[model samples]
Target chain A: MTESWLRLAPGFFALGALAAWELAVRGFGVPVYILPGPIAIVAAFLTDPGGLGGSLLATLTVTLTALVTSAVLGAALAMAMAASRLARAAILPWAVVLQVTPIVAIAPLVIIWVGDPFASLVVCATIVAFFPVFANTATGLAAGAPEYFDLFRLYGASHRDTLLLLRVPVALPYFLAGLRISGGLALVGAVVAEFVTGSGGFASGLAYRILESGYRLEVARMFAALVLLSLAGIVINLALGAFGAAVLRARDGP
Target chain B: MLDIVSVERRFARGVVALEDVTLRLEEGNFLALLGPSGCGKSTLLRLIAGLDRPDGGRLTWDRGRAPAAGEIGFVFQDATLLPWASAADNVFLPLRLRHVSRAEAMPAVHDALARVGLAGFESARPRELSGGMRMRVSIARALVTRPLLLLMDEPFAALDEFTRHGLQADLVALWREIGCTIVFVTHSIYEAAFVAQRVVLMTPRPGRIFREIVSTLTPGPDLRLDPGYATLVTSISKTMAAVLAPA
Candidate 1:
């Protein structure tokens, strides 16, 4: 069907590019180490998926753990900021500082301080993911319609009730928007942290696999590891997007 | 009975919103505070509802004790329904805030929605409803608590004439049925004359009562076409024009 073909257009382009790359490498007599073709990368993936699979899973676990931690901690901080002006004033500047500081710059110090490579990577990733959620949720909490505040106050609603009923619901859309941004950032942070830690030959996440393959002149295996990392990032973003859409539908009802 | 004794309100920016306003509201009386824009009509209502404090005068309810915010039902100019909530959930808000379970509040919620003629639309969100329907939901939320004093600020000013008329009739019927004191605020002369037993006309800057018009005809569909209602409307309109005209 045309509709189905149109939907698969991106896939066709990807396949076409791979075919062209394979032809170019073979046609040009390029060496396998410097410029491996798509076929060689696929062969590498098929040959040792067991080892590659373990590394992919490890990277994915750290990425997901960091994302969840960021969301929970960020939402709590946002709520606290909404509840008290003093807290907002005291905490907001530090959050901004964390956001502006490059994760790569801090990764070395974090690795040294934490000692455990996994914890260090998670802390680095969480630092990267926290800002978007915190800023968006804080803005959303304060963005409640003025009429709603008056209505709640007229009803003698307690502060707890106002926060729970009015502020939280108002903050949902903004928080979800932030979550989508945080999802991709979390993955990027994980890979960057892993790359920094892998330089010391410590762990077995996908970044380390890529590093090891590069060092051993296994260009095909490195590309395969890179492919897995890209796939993980795409999956994280899509899953977060789907979850946000579901929550919005639920809020609006049928 | 509610008494407002020389109420004075001044905003922080040195703008006088209300000045030495004094009025008394009897139990079960349907009164309309009719005025032009920026005339402190809403300011006075806020004072009565205890949403804002008057700088000078005192407001005393029955037995010289002011009613708590929970005891007064206030409706804003806009519908102000939580867009995220269903009509039933919106109506259940006050009761829920008082720690009433949803199951326990269901009957009262249903009753309030029914009173506003929104019986079957309980599951609909505010965005799903028409403007009139949304306003009805707002009224339902205000009425769910069954407060003895109802304060409405231009509640139907945004609706079409047909919907406004329909709501006005329904409001009169509900008022008669519930016997709650309603202090309705509006700029519409017809609306004031149509629904209220007494219309308190107000002047513009630092608003104070300019004139009081009492309708002798009872509120009903026939009252709209009645010669008496026309005369009352004309008199109130003339008074408003005179008061609002720049000297």
Candidate 2:
């Protein structure tokens, strides 16, 4: 029973906080405009979920696109860095520079240059997500046990063979870890890009819905959109967590 | 047969790892290079495996040709199996590198694992096995290629005594059955005596051979308790101690 209590602790705490919030709003007669209660937010969501759902889908598509792009590009760049010193010295610094520069600051320029709202958001998000994967994978590739390399060389394994068989497996856990972090960063970048672009269209995401709700003083609806955005972030993280666990478990061989 | 005539190796940092190290290895003989750490025993093994080249001296084979890439199999001090691969995949690595398809190599891989007593462990990962079992997988990997020469660098140094002795016996049996020349490097005196037909004692710092003793007692399960085995271990230990003594 104690073990079960410990396992259920987090869920209970979240429920308690929501109940307290709902009671506090109702007990104090807090106006919906100042701070919407949990019940009011649910009422707002039930009023017109079609709009909120569309926004959620739009943001989700951008987030997935950015994440997949960063993963592929980051892994390829890391492999290049591992394979050649010249490539590492030449390109890795630029990647670091992109990582250090604030994505919000880059968002405007990316939007203007790409001229397509969706593509620009993807570019911005990819920049945000790329560094963790690249840096982690490079460290992993370089850290391969020296003795394993000697064994590969003894077998006369080609450079390609060593990279694919030896280094790739060694880098897998690190890469998966980076993927989980990148998944969250990709979502953050997508939202930030959406806010900066301010592209008023039928395909506008949750960021635009939040902005539009704030302007109209629809605090309850704004909270509903905010809740959905939080849910989206949680879903992305959980999905990536599942993926990383599955891949890293391969080390255990079934 | 392989000949190492006066091989000399010195690192660029001016550490003389070997000086005039000369030895001849007869095919199918089990030999141990026994010495303290930093005695260039591993360096010499690397030279034989062609993983490193000597700054001096020549190596010639009986076939009058340099040993081809696939002609040598090396086991490091660690099992060194790919953590993500199954025991069978790890054993099949050398043949895979030679471009043999997995289906074509599965039979030989299974046979190698069976020889190492890992018959039912074809799909097990390195982490799933105990230390002794992992070392057995390493041995199976080394034997899979059927190399003419097998070089092991303290492969059992990390295991407990019981596991070490068990592996030592297995190695001897494998050697007799497989008929490959083995040059095992170890710092253990009894291990050298128990496993090798000839134990070569090496001195520290710019390691050179101090002596080579040939064991007359036949290797068997009873050899560890036999008086002859104890005699050989004592004699080898005394020689090793003298070399390890401060000048």
Q: Relative to the unseen true structure, what is the C-alpha lDDT of residue B179 in candidate 1, on a scale of 0 to 100?
A: 92
Runs of candidate 1 with Cα error greater than 4 angstroms are A1-5, A26-34
Q: For each candidate, give its TM-score against the true structure.
A: 0.92, 0.93
RMSD of each: 2.4, 2.2
Model 2: runs farther than 4 Å from truth? A199-203, A249-252
In TM-score terms, which candidate is top? 2
Top DockQ hit: 2
lDDT of model 2, residue B214: 98
Q: Can you write out model 1's per-residue Cα lDDT over B87-151, one digit (the tens) per residue? A: 99999998988889999999999999999999899899899999999989988888888898999
* TM-score on B-chain, cand. 2: 0.98
Please provide, for model 2 over A76-165, each residue's C-alpha lDDT reduced to its tens digit, 9 standing for 90 to 100: 999999889999999888998999999989888888788777899899889888888878888888878889889999989998999999
- Candidate 2: residue B182 lDDT (0-100): 96
The collision pairs in model 1 are none
DockQ, per-model, please? 0.63, 0.72
Could you give candidate 1's per-residue lDDT for residues A1-254 as a string of tens digits? 99999999999999999899999999999999999998899899999999999999988888889989999999999999999999999999999999999998999999999988789989999999989988999999999888789888887788899999999999999999999999899888988999998868357889899989999999999999999989988888889999999999998787
